[model samples]
Target: MQVTIDKNSGYCFGVEFAIQMAEDELAHGGMLYCLGDIVHNRMEVERLNQKGLRVIDREQLELLHDCKVLIRAHGEPPETYALALRNNLELIDASCPVVLKLQNRVKHAFDLSQRQDGQIVIYGQPGHAEVAGLAGQTGNRALIVMTEADLDQVDFARPVTLFSQTTKSTAGFYKMKALMEARIAAAGGTLDSFDANDSICRQVSNREPQLAIFAAQHDVVLFVSGRKSSNGKALFSVVNAVNPRSYFIENEGELQDEWFAGAATVGICGATSTPLWLMRQVAEGVESMGELV
Candidate 1:
């Protein structure tokens, strides 16, 4: 049996930077309060928690004062900064540059939309951290849509500007765009009044094709990613589409021996938030199964 890990599977630059910042802060021998999970993976979060990282919710953040808080890669809304000021809290901002730029763009779009009576629409999970941050830029006026049903909230007759979450699948974004275009036409609105931006991160979009190729090359594919990771769900769909033998697991412990039955080659891959070490661990587990095969 052969076990291989995809070279393309691991943390994106933004996630890597945030984790590095957290580790650097933790190295100074103090408790670092993170606004949320530094990354979606529980194993990695637990590992960091052992190093004095404490994940806190928004309610908890409001109650704390005059302490250092680390902003995860997902970023935060303007109100979080306002609250920090009120509480005299020091924020170690580790927001991804991509997300920050998107927020700026959304804010600018929102201002323009207000003048034309337009709507700001986002293709993302409604309550996701990144979506919340993006919505904050528009003063929470942006319409969040995950499926055709969510599009019901959108006024197709009005001028609409659409932006996608950075971690969302490229196909999903384009699908939403198409749906919006169809709706606009049905409403007798010209496409000129519609603006759709494919704002997904290049690092993430590029991975789809790479992952498709990787998945096809393996006999059995094990996709390791945290269940809550948006990128994980998107990428796993791609892998599973290419290779029906694909299995999504958070860790090696979830691996089943039945999955390895008659599998000569096994491929291990993960989402952008996934750590390479976790993939390596999964690879070792596959190798152990190889002996039994």
Candidate 2:
């Protein structure tokens, strides 16, 4: 049996930066608090937790008045930073540069739109950390559009500036944009669709095409990813669609021997948030199991 790993299957720049910041802080032996999971991957979070990184929520921040806190790569709202300052907490910001840029774009667009009697529309999941942060920039003026249906909440006659969460599906974003434009045109109203940024990180946007090729090259696929990662979920769908023999697992322990029972060639791939070391371990486990068989 042959085994292959996808070249792009591993931690993306954002997750890599966040994890490195956490590890650097932990190695110095100080009290470190992460505002959220450093990343969505449970294994990576647990590993950091073992190294003395404490994950805290808003309430926890309130209780611990004087402490050092690290903002996750997901990035929090300005109010969150304000609260940290009000509590006299030392801040260690680790927000991804891409997310930080999106936040700035949303804030700037919202500011300009508000002056011109326009609205800021965000294409993202409601209540998601990133969405919440972007919405906060608009002081709640930003409208969240998870689907074309959510467009009903906006005034079609007015001008709209659209932005998307960094991890949103590019295809879905374009479809929603086209639908909104169609609705406005049908209404015979003067609608200014200002900007539609494809804010999705390349780490995710590039995975679909790569997965399609990877799926075609292998007979059976072992996809490793944390269930909570949005990018992982998106990429997994692509892989499964292209290759029916694909299986998803969080780690080596979850790998079922039955998956390899009749397979001659295997391929291993993982999400952007997945660590390379973890994937290697899973591959090694698979190799060892194959030898026994």
Candidate 3:
């Protein structure tokens, strides 16, 4: 049996930057409070926790004072800063540059829409942290649409500016864009009248096609990812679509021997939120399983 790990799978630049900030703070020996899970991956979170990074919630944030709070790559709204200020807390902002730019763009569009009676439409998971941040820029008035059906909530009779979460699928974003455009056109609008931003990160957008091709080359594919990773679920769908013998597992314990019974080559891959060491750990498990096969 031959076992290989997808070279392209692991933490993207933003997540890497966030985790590195947490590590650096923890090494310096201070009370480091990460606003949320530093990354979606539990293994990486646990690793950081063991190294003295404490994850805190918004409610807990309000009660704390005079400590450093690290904002993860999922940027927070202006309200978070206000709250931090009231409590005299210092914010170690590690917000992704991509997300920060998107927030500013959304705020600007929202400001313009308010005057012209337009709407700010965001294509993302409704309650997602990143989406919440984007919406906060609009004073929480941006219409959140996770699917084409959610587009009905928008008033196409008025101007609409559309933006997307940084980690969402590029194809999915464009598909939603097309559907929204058609809806607006039917309501007597044109492409020139609507504003659409393809804001999905290039690093993530490029991986979908790469993963599909990688899955097709292997007899069996293992998709290693944390359960909370949206990109993991999206990229895994690409793999499953290209190869029927694909499995999603968080770690070695979830790997089943049946997945490799007749397979000569196994491919392992993971999401951008996944740590490289975790993928290497899965590769080691695959190596052991190959010996059994």
Candidate 4:
């Protein structure tokens, strides 16, 4: 059996930066509190937790004071900063530059929308950390839509400005844009009154075509990612579509010997948030399975 790992797979720059920041802080021999899971991958989180990184939620953050808290790649809303100030907590912000820029754009657009009596709409997973951060930019007034049914909340008669979560699939964002355009027409509104921005990060969108090619090249593909990762789901969809033999797993332990039956070549790939070491471990597992098969 021939096993290979996709060179394009693994942590995007934003996630790599955040994890590095966490590790650098931990190296100083001090207790560090993280606002959430440093990354979507549970194995990576567990590894950091062993290094004295404590993951806390919003409620926990509210109750703590006079300590250092590390914000993950997913940026926090204005409210979080306000709360941190009130509690005298030192914030070690590691927010992704892309997310920060999106937040700024959303805030600016929201201000403009107010003058025209327009609504801010977000194409994102409802209640997601990054979505919450983006919604916070609009003062929690942005209508979050994932499916066609979620569009019911929008007022089609009014002017609408739409933005997508930075990590969302490119196809999904365009579909949402088309849906909004149709809704505007149905409400007797012109396209000029609606604005849709494809805010998905280039790092993610660019990977789809590359990953599709990678998936097709292998007889069997192992997609490693945390099930909770948004981009993991998005990218895996592309892989599964290209190669029906693809299997999504979080770690090496999830590998099945039966999956390699008669397979001459195997490929390993993962999401932007996936760690490289994890992919290497998966590759090793696949190689070991070759002997058994």
Clashing residue pairs in candidate 4 are none
lDDT of 4 by residue, 3-116 (tens): 999999999999999999999999998899999899999999999999999999999998998999998998999999999899999999999999999999999999999999
Provide the lowest-lDDT 10-residue window in model 1: 284-293
Clashing residue pairs found in predicted model 3:
none
Task: Give per-residue CA lDDT, model 3, range 1-293, as digits (tens).
Answer: 78888999898998999988888878889789989888889888898888889999989999999999999998999999999999999998999998998899999999998999999999888788899899999999999998877988988888889998888888789999999989988999877769999999889999999999999999999999999888888889899999999999998888888788878888999999988899889889888765544
- Measured with C-alpha atoms, the lDDT of residue 217 in candidate 1 is 97
Q: Highest lDDT among the candidates is held by which one?
A: 1
lDDT of 4: 0.94
How would you encode candidate 1's per-residue C-alpha lDDT over 211-244 as one tens digit per residue?
Answer: 9999999889999999999999999999999999
lDDT of each: 0.95, 0.84, 0.90, 0.94
True-structure RMSD, every candidate: 0.7, 1.9, 1.2, 0.8
Candidate 3 has its poorest 10 consecutive residues by lDDT at 284-293
Q: Which of candidates 1 and 3 is the stronger one according to TM-score?
A: 1
- Higher-lDDT candidate among 1 and 3? 1
lDDT of 3 at 1: 73
List the candidate numbers ranked by TM-score, top first: 1, 4, 3, 2
Q: How high is each candidate's TM-score? A: 0.99, 0.93, 0.97, 0.99
The sequence of per-residue lDDT tens digits that candidate 2 reaches over residues 81-143 is: 889879999888888899899899889988888788888989988877778888989887799
Sort the predicted structures by lDDT, highest score first: 1, 4, 3, 2
